[model samples]
Target: MESGFGTRRRTRLFDDLLALFLAEGFSQFTLDDIAAALHCSKSTLYTLAASKDDLVRRVTVHFFKRATAAVETTLSRNDDPRERVAAYLTAVGAELAVASEVFMADLNAFPPAREVYEANTAAAATRVRQLIEEGVDAGAFRAVNASFAGDLIATMMVRIQQRDVGKATGLSDAEAYTELATLLTNGLRT
Candidate 1:
C-alpha cells in the first residue's frame, strides 16, 4: 500500500530513516520495528521501498549521498589548503559521530551496507589524496607520496570503524577518529 506523499515528505521520511539507521544499525530493525520507531505504518514504508532489504539499501544510499555532499560543502568553506584537509577529515568523523557500537557492528555484518560503506571510504581516500596534493602545493604538507598516504588513511579509517579499536584502546569511534585526525595532520605538517 503506497502512500502518495509529496517528494518533500518522502525525502523527510528518508532522513528520519537514515538517522535511525545511524543510531541503531540495520540488522536488528525489522520493518515493524522501524514503523514503530518512525511512528509510521508498514504500508507507508512500502511507499519508500518494497522490502526490508530494499529499504536498507535505499536508506544506506541516501545516507552516503548526503554525507558526501555535506563533506564537500564543508570542505569548500575553507580556503586554506591545510584547513581544507582538516575539515575533510573532521567531516568524515562527523558522519560517524552518531554511529554507536551496535550500529557499526550491524553495518559491517550486513554485506550490502558494508559494501556501500567501503565505497564511501574509497571515495574519501580519493578526496584525502587531492587534499594532500593541495597542501603540498601550498607548502603546508611535505611532498611525499600523497597517494600512498591517502591509502594509509583509508586503511586506518576502516580499522577505526572496527569494534576492536574501541575495545582495545578504550576510545569510542568518535574518539578514535579524532585521534586519527590528530596523528595524520601532525605527521603531514611541514
Candidate 2:
C-alpha cells in the first residue's frame, strides 16, 4: 500500500505535470522529455500512468477537475444570480487562460484529451442552464428560454474549444468565454 508520503508525492507530481502541459502542451513531449522536464525518472511518471498517452489524459482530467472546483468556488461567492453567472464564466475563463495556444491546439488534436474537454463543456452547459433558471425564477433576469440560452452558450463554448472562434474572430478560448459572459449577462438582464 502507498504511504501518505507516497500519495502526496504522486499528487505533487500530477500537479507539476499538469502545469507543464498547460504551459507547453503534451503532444510534442516524449516520456524522456517529460521526465527531464519534471526532474524525475521515467519510472516515476509510469507510477502515475502506464504510458505517455495515459499520462496526458490523466493530466487533462486533473486540469478540468481543478478548474471546475475553482469556477464553482467563484460562483458560490456571488449571491446575486447575475453575478453568479458572470463569476462562474469568468472563473472558467481565468482558469483556461493559463493554457497556452499550443496547449489548446494539442488538446483539440488528441481525441482522448478532447473528449475530457467535451464532457466538461457539457457539464458546464448544464450548470449554466440551471443558473439561468435560477435567475429567471428569482426575477433577476428577463424571461428567457433557459434551455435555448444554455444551448446557445454551449454551442459557442464548443466552438471556442474547437478553435473555430479563434480562427474566425482571432479570439482565444479565454477571450471568447469572457465575451460570452458579458453578452449573456447583458442579454438576460431585466
Candidate 3:
C-alpha cells in the first residue's frame, strides 16, 4: 500500500524529471547528466528507475498520460464546439511549449517513447474528428470533409511537433498552436 503523501511526492518528482526531459531531451542524457540537471546525485535517481531507459519510458508515459488528461479536461470545460476546438489545440501547444528541438528529435528516435507519442497523436486525431463531426452536426462549422480534415490536422500537428518546422517558420510551438486554433476556428465556422 502506498501512502498518500508518498504518492504526491513521487508525482512531483516525476513532473520535475519530465520538465528536464522536455528542456534537454532523453536519448542523449546519461544518468549523471540527469543528476546534474536535477541538482541531485546519481544514487538519488536510482529510487526512481533502475536504468536511464526505464526512467525515460516511465517519465514519457507519465507525461503523455497527464497531457492527454489535460486535453480531455480542456475539451470538457467549454460547451461551445468552436471553443472546444480552440481549447484542444491550445492545450496541445501549451504542453509542448517547453520542449526543445533536441528533445523532440530524441523522443522520436527512441522507439518506445516514439510509439507512445505516435499512439497518442492518433487518439487525439480521433477526438478531433469527433469534434468536427459534432460541430458540423450543430451547424456551427462548415460542412467540410471531416475525415480528410481530421487527418490533415493530425499531420499538421505532427509536423509542428518536429523541430525543423519551428526553425524554418521562426515560430515557437505555442505561437504555432495559437495560429492553428485561429486557422481552425475561422475555417470551420459557418
Candidate 4:
C-alpha cells in the first residue's frame, strides 16, 4: 500500500503535470518537455507515472472525477427527476463552457485519452439511468428501459453539447438547457 504522503505527492505531481499538458498540448510534448514544464527531472515524472500513456490516463481520470462530482452535487439538490436531469445537463454545459481551451485542445490531440473519456461517459450514463428508473417508479416519467433510454439520452446530449461548444453556436447556456429539457421531457413524458 502507498503511504499517505506518497499518495499526496503523486497527486500533486499528477495535477501539475496535467496542467502543463493541457496548457502546452500533449501530442507535442516529450518527457524532457514535461520535466522542463514541471521544473523537475524526467526521472521524477517516471517515479510518479510509468509512461506518457499512464500520465494521460491519470489526468483524464482526474478531470472526469471532478466533472462527476459536479454532476452529483447538481443531482442531490433536486428530487424531481426532470429537474434533476435538467440540472445535470446544465451543469455539464456550464463545465464545458468554462473548461480551459487548452484542455479541449489537448484532448483533441491525444487519442489514448479516448478510452478514459468513454469510461467516464458511460458512468454518467449509468447515473442517468438510475435517475430515470427512479422517476418511472414514481410515475414521473414514462415506463421505459431506463438503462437503454438513459444511455441514448446521455449520448445525444453529449454530442449536441460538444457541437455547440466547438461551433460556438452563440446559444446561451440557458437556451441550450431549455432546448435539451424540452426534447427530453417530450420523449420521457408519461
Top lDDT hit: 2
lDDT of 4 by residue, 89-135 (tens): 66765654544565665665566675666666566667667777887
Pairwise lDDT winner, candidates 3 and 4: 3
Clashing pairs in 4: none
Q: Which has the greatest TM-score?
A: 2
Model 2: per-residue Cα lDDT over 1-190, one tens digit each: 9999999998899999998998998899999999999999999999999999899999999999999999998888889987778888888899999999999999999999999999999999899989999999999999999999999988988998889999999998898899999999999999
Candidate 3: residue 92 Cα off by (Å):
0.9
The candidate with the higher TM-score, 1 or 2, is 2
Q: Report the lDDT tens digits of candidate 1 across residue range 1-190.
A: 4356688789999999988988778787889999999999999999999999889888888888998898899888888876777788888778777776777788777787878888887888888888998899889887778879988988877776555677789887677767877888888888
Query: C-alpha displacement of 11 in model 2, angstroms?
Result: 1.1
In model 3, state the lDDT of residue 112.
76
Name the runs in model 4 displaced over 4 angstroms: 142-148, 157-182, 185-190
**Candidate 3 at residue 13, lDDT?**
78
User: Residue 65 deviation, candidate 2, in Å?
Assistant: 0.4
Instruction: Tell me how candidate 2 scores on lDDT.
Output: 0.92
Ranking by lDDT: 2, 1, 3, 4
